[model samples]
Target: MTNLYTGCPKMKEMDGRAVLILFIMLTLVKTEGLVSVTTGSDYVVTRVGENQTISLDVSRAGGEFRVSFNDSTEYLFHKFNNSDLKRVNNNRTLYRDRYRVRGNITSSVFRLTLYNVTTEDAGIYECQKFEGNQRVPGCKQLLIVARNPSQPNITGPASAVSGGSVTLTCSSSSRSLPPDHPPLTMNYTWKRNSEEIQGGGDVSVDGPNLTMKDISREKAGNYTCQAKEEELKSDWSARHVLDVQYGPNTVHFNETHDKVTATEGDPLTVRCSADCNPACTVTWLDTSRQKVTSGQREAVLSIPAVNRSLSDLYTCHVNNTHGNKSRNLKLDIQYGPYTVQFNEIDDKVTATEGDPLTVTCSADCNPTCTVTWWDTYKQRVTSGHREAVLSIPAVNRSLSDLYTCHVNNTHGNKSRNLKLDIQYPPSVKTFSDISINNITRKVDSVSFLCVVDGNPKPSVYLRHDLTNRTYPMTCETLSKSIYTSHQYYECTHTNENFDVFLHGAYSCRAENTVGHVDSRAVVVTVPSK
Candidate 1:
C-alpha cells in the first residue's frame, strides 16, 4: 500500500495474487458533491480553513496502520497494534500538529483529520493497513480550494444617452495555488437594482462583460456583479448608477377650466409640463412654430384678456439631446361681431320706383356669426353668414324704409341700419273698374273716376283729347290714402245738349316733374237707337 505522504513512495508487491480494492472513501468539509476517481486514488474537494477527514473501513485491516501524503515514504501519522499515535518528524510530509489519528485496531475502524487546510496543503492523502504480512491498498487525494474571490468592480461610464450602446466589465481574483493543480473555474453573474439580469435581445452577457444596444431610459439603474468559483460566492461589487439622458415624455397640462372655448375678454392661463432626465427644456410655440415662451421642464402661457385673433392655435414643445416632442392645445373665443358695415353700399340708399336694388352688409366675428336682414317691422327678411344680402328685384315707392342687417353669436350681437328711398314717375290708374271714359248720350251729366299714384301728390286733371291740350274738365282730390300713394279723384263733363260736337274723346292725365301718362278716351253713344 502507498500512503499519501511523499518521501519517494515504495509499493509493496502482492504475492502472486491480484487484490481487488476500492475501499478508501474521500469526504469533504461542509460542501456536498461527487468525488472524482482515477485508476488508484479517489479525490476529495474542500475550501481553505476547512478540515478534510478521510475514512477507512478497517474490517479487513491488520492491527497496524500508517497515513501518508503525496506518496511520501515518511508517515504523516502512524499507529501499531492499538498503541498511541507515533511521532511524525521524519523530515517528510505534513507535520504532526496539523493531522490527527482516531479509532482503535480492535474495533476495526480508522480515520484521519487534516486540520487548518490551506492551498499549500492540497495533495493526495492515504492510509495504509497491514494484516499480518499482507498489505491493504487504501488511498485518496485531498484538494483544498482557495478562498472566495475578491470583490468585483464594474467599469463603465457614469451616464449614457438613450438609443445608444453601453458596455460594462467586471473583474475579480482570489488566492493562487501550486502549478501542479488546475485552477478553479470561475462563473460570473450580473444584477440590476439587486435583481438578477437575464440577458437577451439588446442586452447580452459575455463572461464578465455586460453589453447593451439601443438603450432606453427605463433600463437605467444601479448595477453590480458577483463571482462564483466551485460553489463559493464572492461579495457583490459596488453599485454603479447609470444615468440615461433622454428627451421629454408623458406630457401634462394644468388649467382651471376646459380651454377648448371661452368668451371674449375672459382671463386665461395655462401651463405645460413633461417628464425627462437632466430636466428637458420646454417652450411655447405659435401656430407658425415660432417660439413664444422658453423654460426648463415646464412652461407657462398667459393671456390677460382673450380676443378672437388669439384663438384657434397654440402649441407646446419640449426637447433634449435625444429627441423632441410637441402637442397642440385648443383655444376658441366666442365674441360678438366687431367689423360690421355695409359692403360698398351705404346706410342711406336711394332707388327709382321701378329699378332693381341690392344692399349687402359685412361683419367679422368669432364662433361664426349668423347674419339676418330685418325690415322696419322687425321681420326676418333673409338669413345667412355675416354677408347678409337684401335684394329687391323690382323696387316700388313702398319699399322706402329703414332695414337692419343684424349679425349675432352666442356671446353677443351687432346690427347695422340702412334706409332706402324709392322714386318714380306718376301714373294714373282708373278707379271704380272704369279703365275707359264711357257714357250714354241720354245721360245729362257724366262723371269719371281714376286713381293717381305718385311720389309727390301729382296734379291730376280731365282733358278732352281733341281740344288742343286743354284740361277742359274739373279734377280734384277727394281723399288721400294714408298707407299708400292712392289719391281718389273725380272728374265730370256735362252739356245740356248732348251732341256729337261735344262728344269728343275725353281722358285724364297725371303729370309729375318725372314724366306723364294719359288714360283712354271717354265715349258717348245713343242707347238702343
Candidate 2:
C-alpha cells in the first residue's frame, strides 16, 4: 500500500512540501553574535577653569541580548530597561529579547551628566552586552579634566579714616565652571590674619567684595581673599598694611618769669604755660627746676611790689599723660644807693717832711666803692683817706693844709675836710733778754724773764726746756721771779728729763697763741745707785 501511494502523488505533493519548508526557514534565527558598541566621540578634553560634554551610543543586534552602560560609578548608568524584557542572567536581564515583527531591528543609547568634572573622571568606562550568561562586548574609557583658574587680584586702601567705610575687591581674569555638568556654586571666605570675618547683609556675591562701615582703630589688620569650588580652594591674594595718625594737644615751658633785676617799689610778673590736648597741667619750678608750691592759672603772673633779695630762676612745667614740657625765666632784684657809717681817724700823727703817708677811709653802702683824699691847696693828693696830713722838710710856717677825705659806695658818695699837725716824743724804748736757755737738767725751780716798754704794756711767760709746758708768770708789774716744777699725768707734754721711748725721739716746744719757740732735744740719764 505504501509503495503504490508514494508513486501516484509525487509532483503535486513535492511542490506543496517545498513551499512549507521555505516559510519555516525564513522565520528561524540563523546566527547569534554582536556588533561593537560605539560612542559619539572617542576622545574628550577639558580645562581646569572650564567644563565639557560627552554622549554614549550602543547600536547592535542579536536574539535575546541585553545591553548595559557600566559607568565608573558603582550604581552604573540610570537604567532604561524595556518593560517586555526578561532576565537573561542574574547580572543582566533580557531587554527587548524578541522583536514584535520579523526582521525589525532597533538600538539603545544612554546619556550621562557630570557635575564639577575634574581629572579624577579620566579613566576607562565599560560598555557591556550579554545574552543568557554570554558576553557580546565590553566597556570603554572616557576622559575629563579642568583647567586651572586664574589668580585673583585684590584692591583696597592701606588705612581708612575713623568712622569711615572701607571696601576690598577680589577678582579673577577667567572665572567659569565646567560645561560637562551643571554650573558649580562657588564659595567665598573673607578673613583677617587667619580669622574669618563676619559680614553683614551688605555682602555681594557677584563682586566678591567686603565692605566694612564705620571703621575704627580696632579694624586694622591683614586681609585675605579666597574662592573655592567643589573640593578645590584657590590661593590667597597679596597682603595689605594700614596705619592711622593725629595730634597737637598740649604746650608748656620750663620757666614762668624773666626779669633779672627789680628795684624796690617796682611791679613784677611771670608766666608758666603749656599747650596740649586734653589740657596740660601747669606747675612752677624753682632755680633747681624742681616743682615748687604756688602756681596759678593767670594769663600773666603779677607781683605787687619787688624787693632786693628776690633773685632766682623761675620755671614753668607743663605735663600730660603723653609727655612733659618746660620753660625757664630768670628774676633778679636790686636796691639801695646809700651809705650809713663814716671812717675813724687818729687825732695826732708824727711825720717827716715829704714823707709818704697812708690813710684809709671806710664806709658802708649798697655796693663797695672807692675813696679819695685832697689837700687844702686844692691839689689832689693820694686818694682814700680818713686822716690826711701835709708836711714840709722842716716845718715851715707854710707847712699847713686842710686835708679833705672822701668815701663812697654804690649807695652814695661823701667827702669831709680835716686839719693835720705833727709832734715828736722821746725815743720809744724796748728791752732785750738772753735768747739761749738750752741747759737740760732736773730742777725744782727755774727763772727767766722778758721785759719791753712801748705805748702799750707787754706781758712775758716762762717755758720749760725739758718739757713743752708754758706757764703764765704772775707777779708785781716789772718783776722777775723763779717758778717750781710740777709733774702731770696724761698730758700731751713730754719732758726731756724722762727717758725717750725705745724707738722714739723727745723734744720741747713752747708757743703763745700768737708765736712759737722751741728748744733743742735734751737727753737725760738716771744715776744707778
Candidate 3:
C-alpha cells in the first residue's frame, strides 16, 4: 500500500519474477518440437534367410527428417537424409546388397527393411532425427534379434555291425552373416527316434560330434540334431537311419519233431535252422563226433541208407562270425527178426511118456519180435516177445511131432522147426487072452497070446518055472495109437507030452530099452481022456 506503482523496488522485483516465468514458459514451448515418434516394441526376433522390417511412427512434424540405424557394438548399417543415404564403415559393404529403406521422408511413418538377416545383425538399433547440429530429444530404439541357427546336417555311417563303433557330426552354414562376424555360439542337442539322446553308456557327445561305442541292435534308430542359441531354437535336421547287424542266438528244430525214424536200408534226412543277420554254415556230426556232412549254407543232413550203426544221436552245428551253436537229435532204425533158432538139449527132443516137455525158440531183432509157436498142424502152441516155448504137460505118442516158432515184427518174419520124440517102457495088459485054439486033446495045437505096449518094439517070451526052461515068443508091432505102439506076442506047444508035467507055471516077459515087465503065471491043466 505504500504507493507501490511509484518507483517502488518491491514492485520492480515482482515484475522481474513474472517476466522470468513467462520467458521460461516460452522457451519450453519452443524447445518441444511438433514431431512425435513411437514404437510398439523394443526388440524384434527373426531368422536367417528371412526378411525383417523395423517400423517407427513419426507424426505432427514439418520439414525434412533423417533416420539412422546403429548398434551398441558401434556397427552402423544405414543412414538416410531425404532421398540421399550412406552406409558407414565396413557395414556399408555388408548391408549395401541386402538392406533397404522404405516410406517417404514426408510421411508420418517410416520403415527400415533388412533382407536375408543374419546373426551379425543381432543388436540394438537406434533411429534418430537431426536438425542442423542439434539432435532431437525423442529417438526410437530398435532391438533387432537374430533368428535360430540353420538346420543342422548329420554325417556318419548308415549301417554298422553289432559291437562296432561309429561317429556322427552335426554341422550348419551361415552364408548370410558378415565375413568379420565371430563364429556362432550354439548349443547342440541330439535325438534318437524322436527322443532326446543322453550321453552315457555306449553314447558320447563332444560339441557337435556324437560317438557311439559297442553299438548293438538296441542302439539302431533314426537320429537328428538341433541347434539352439539363447532363446532361439532350430528345426530338427533330416532323419538318418542306422542299421545294426548281428548273429544268431540259438540253433534248433522248428517244432517238437526232433527225432527221426527210418527202416533199415531206407533213406533218412533231418533239417535244422537258426536266426541270424549273416548266413550261417551248417554241419552234421555222427555219434563218434566225426563230420558226416561238410559245412554248407543249407541246414540239412541226409543219409542214403539207414543201418543199425547209423541209429544214434546226431549233432547239428551252426557257426557264424558272432558265435556258434549246436543241436542234437536221435535217429532210430527198425529192422526185422533174424537168426531165429530153437533152444533145445539136442536136435531131436526126447521125453518119456506122461512126462513134461518144453522147447524154446530165440531170435535177434531191433524192435524185439513177436514170437509165436506153431505145431505141424499150423496151430499156435505158444507166443512171447523175444523167445517162445512149446510145452506138453503129459507127453504121449500123440504129442510126438514137429514144432515151429514164428518170429515177426514191422520189418519181416522168420521161423524155426524142432522135432519131438516120446519114449515109454513096456507094458503088458493080457497074456492069456492071446488068440489061440482051445487045447482040448493032447495032440491038438495049443497057443498063448500076450498083448504089450511100449515106445520101441519090446521083445516077448514065455518061461516055464518048474522045468526052468524059457520059450521065446514072437511079437508083431501094430499101427501107432494115441498112447503108444501095441505089440502082439504068441507062444505055441504043438504036442502035449511030458512038457505038461514039467510046466508048473508059465509067465510072459516083455523087455525094451527102458525096462522090462512080466505077466501073471498060469498053469496048464490036463483033462482026462
Q: Whose TM-score is greatest here?
A: 1
Candidate 3 Cα errors over 4 Å, as ranges: 1-49, 54-98, 102-111, 116-248, 253-256, 276-281, 287-291, 294-299, 319-324, 339-348, 353-369, 375-400, 409-411, 429-513, 519-529
Reference-based lDDT, each prediction: 0.66, 0.41, 0.62
Candidate 2 lDDT over 1-529, as tens digits, reads 0111122221111111111000000111112121112213443434342333333343432222333322312313221223122122334222122112211123333232333444554444443333232332432433433233455667878766555677887764333322343334445677777778786653333447788776665566787777764435677766655432112233333353244456566897665555443345677666765655433332344668976554367766666554566556666654443432323555334343335444454554333445566665666766533232332335321343356666665445776655444322111122112221233332222233333221112233344444545545432343311211111111122233332221122233333332343333333332332
Which regions of candidate 1 fall more than 4 Å away from where they truly are?
A: 1-45, 53-87, 90-112, 115-142, 175-182, 248-259, 274-278, 426-529
lDDT of 2 at 241: 56
TM-score of 1: 0.63
Judged by TM-score relative to the true structure, which candidate is superior, 1 or 3? Answer: 1
On a 0 to 100 scale, what is the lDDT of residue 445 in model 1? 49
**TM-score ranking, high to low:** 1, 3, 2
Q: After best superposition, candidate 3 residue 296: deviation in angstroms?
A: 4.2
Cα lDDT of candidate 2 equals 0.41
Model 2 — TM-score against the truth?
A: 0.26
The top-ranked prediction according to lDDT is: 1
Higher-ranked by lDDT: 1 or 2: 1
Model 2 regions more than 4 Å off:
1-261, 288-301, 340-529
